[model samples]
Target chain A: MGFLGYRRPDGSVGIRNYVAVMSSVSCANGVVNALSREMTEIKPIIHTEGCGRGLADIAISTRTLAGLGKNPNVAAILIVGLGCEFIKAPGLADQIKPSQKPVEFLVIQENGGTVKTTRKAIEICGKFLDYADSIKRTDCGWDKLTLGLECGGSDALSGVTANPVIGVAADWLAAQGGTVILAETTEMIGTENILARRAADPAMGEKIKSLIRKQEKLTKDILGPLAGLVISPGNIEGGLSTIQEKALGCIIKAGNSRINELVEYSAAPSKKGLVIMDSPGSDIFQLTGMAASGAQLTLFSTGRGTPAGFPIMPVLKISSNTELFRKMEDDLDLDAGQVLAGKSIEAVGKELVSLMEEVVNGKQTKAEINRQDLLAIHTVGPAF
Target chain B: MQEQINAVLIHPSDNVAVAIREIQPGEAILGLKQKISARQNIPRNHKVALVEISIGAKIIKYGETIGIAIQGIEPGDWVHTHNLKAEEI
Candidate 1:
């Protein structure tokens, strides 16, 4: 099951070769984004944090930014900074340099101002892009792929169609010895029992339960007894009522594969098969965390429609409603709404798996074509 | 042959079923081996009471209790945020 990909020196495989222009803090986002826009190969990775946060918050931000640059899909990285930021640009570039990818750093303050820094950043990015574009795609095995599973803007048909279709794909990929990481710890609130039964051992089962309990406690601590109402007006409008009801529907996306391990946000998986990453239910944060954890690609299922995409990984959007699919054709890659229209789940699932194989072999997703690369770091605290 | 209601009946214990499409009031909903008229204009994704429910009874969906009925619900009446309050898990 070898597909055309860029086999990185670090033993990871990437379907696309992208030179990322990463901002170390919110202050440098405009410079990075502008620099990336000037060069076709350089993509901007922007976030809202990186300055004046607590040590724990800064660590999370720094680690997440470094992880994105280290992602195999990124052939090179340009770290942009406002010299006084808490997460130093030079330090972040140093962390990713070990990946053997070409890395550069630009400080706005040191460069005099935004205009001067933007020019220097673009020139550096152009050089990185030139170097990155020279890397050729080679044949890579399915086992080298780590797929991320996520669902957002869900509706009633989510559980009955799109989610299960991805579940089937996840199960198939897992059986083939590839890795699948399911995120959104909040979505697993009430479905712990079902997920636990699929755990490789009793200890893993307990770990899964504990993760759910931790999410419950975190929400309770923030919102008190009415924490269940966190599903919000949107979920209710989409037909979801309780967290338990949403959790039950959400868990259907994980498939029936054995849970091999549980990993923290942005932490790389130790084993293959199915792994769970503890992440907030926020769509962008969840997707970004998975990308940070080394997932080369992500399958995003949405019902009401979301256009979020990552700079490094290609997002395959699957829609459960055919109407929404047609309405948002530019943002969606696959439509599983047929399953809701009486088509068998197996048929749609098999088709989706083939689509993933195509995507791995260089078939550009809708997100790529639309140039919808939305990048954000999961910051833990507010800036001063 | 009559077509079954194009809706998801989440739980066997539930007295309501989710509507997948708009159903005008008085239209016959074909399912559960019974023909029940819609008590009101049920919008897509909204719940319809399958049986008369007393106030304070849990509103079950997805084989789990989702909320509690804020008022008495007649069979075929629409159940939603206005008539149901979120239940603590």
Candidate 2:
């Protein structure tokens, strides 16, 4: 069954409708947090990388922050900033103006101080919440949904059970005209050829190859003797013997769908079906990038268990093994480990899809219940 | 007749299977058409060679080459970092 979602003026769909307060630079995070603490209706977007960075990181930060503001999940947004920071609140708010949502900006230095800026933010955000609350959820089709695929803290069962189960659902969603995003270029190592071959066209296939190739080389150059050459003793001890084996586990979450688009970090998909966003393998950065790309929800599987959720999007956690599922029952959403118990992959996938429906239809996941609102932006280069 | 499954064949084209539970030496490696007994103590979640693989052959799992076998691998041989080498970038 389809779910009820908030439709944006730009025709995008959102599973959640929240009034958000974001810090344009790290200096304003204190005020942003204070506003959220004072107003329970505001989802706070806090981060550490708004300034004191090279141009590359600034570009990434600006794009990511704008993407998060423009994300359909936020019905309204308030940007807070320090006047002297590289990424100012007005500039960031201007980038998100195309969304046609209620937007406001505050400068801590100009607004008197943290206390004064936060007071004004609370007033503006309170009005935004009122506007947000007036909107109602409408029926949305699968075509309006974009689900992101992610996996972290993995064990061997991640590939055999959780990721493959996610794959089946990913392919099913794509077949139904919904969008699925596969990210984390760091985990796409050694399987560049395999993934590229599934691209929508030869040119996109080449792009996929080069994107993964660049990540592989960077991994080697930066993590020499630590990555790319051999499985670490730690990895071997944990039962994985090769980089491909580890990487294969991650890529399976995309299923067999043809990758229709490849977007840069935090860029929105221009097509449906499966898309790959270039992001770090680090869990928080990938989650935030996918969220900023306008994914309404995420399908995150873990073998070792991670309680990571985005500020606005819902994260449905699936466990790779039955034991971990039992151990982390309160934290996980689905149990794919039944595949090892003789259940077929398709069966668990269907179950996962059903669970996904419930979550999208306003069911609170464990992460949401625990208020696991984590956010981070991927920085491509050194600071200062 | 049904056989007890102790390992999982991730893909039909795969030449190796991952043991769902530890397999003792001489125990039959399930999930393969040809009966292959574990040659040594195969750790849980570790790969077992379903077919005898000569050295330098591509090690297949999920129906793709994950790496290359550095040493000749017998059926039910435990594949790890020592014998399985990662593919070069």
| Winner by TM-score | 2
Number of the top-ranking candidate, with lDDT as the measure: 2
Please, what are the lDDT tens digits per residue for candidate 1 over residues A140-210?
88898999999989767787568878988988899888899998887787667767877999999999988
CAPRI level of candidate 1? incorrect
DockQ of predicted model 1: 0.17
TM-score of each: 0.80, 0.91
Residue ranges of candidate 1 with Cα displaced over 4 Å: A229-245, B1-89
Writing each residue's lDDT as its tens digit, candidate 2 over A1-384 gives 577999898888888998999999888989988887899878999999889999989999999999999888899999999999999999999999999988899999999998889889878987898899898999989999999999989886898889989988898899989999999888887778888788889999899999988887888898895676545677677678877887777787988778899999889999999999999878999999998898889999999998888888899999999999999898999999887777767788999988888888889999999889999899878887
All candidates: DockQ: 0.17, 0.46
Best by DockQ: 2
lDDT by candidate, in order shown? 0.81, 0.88
- TM-score of B chain for each model? 0.86, 0.92
The TM-score that candidate 2 achieves is: 0.91
On a 0 to 100 scale, what is the lDDT of residue A314 in model 2? 90
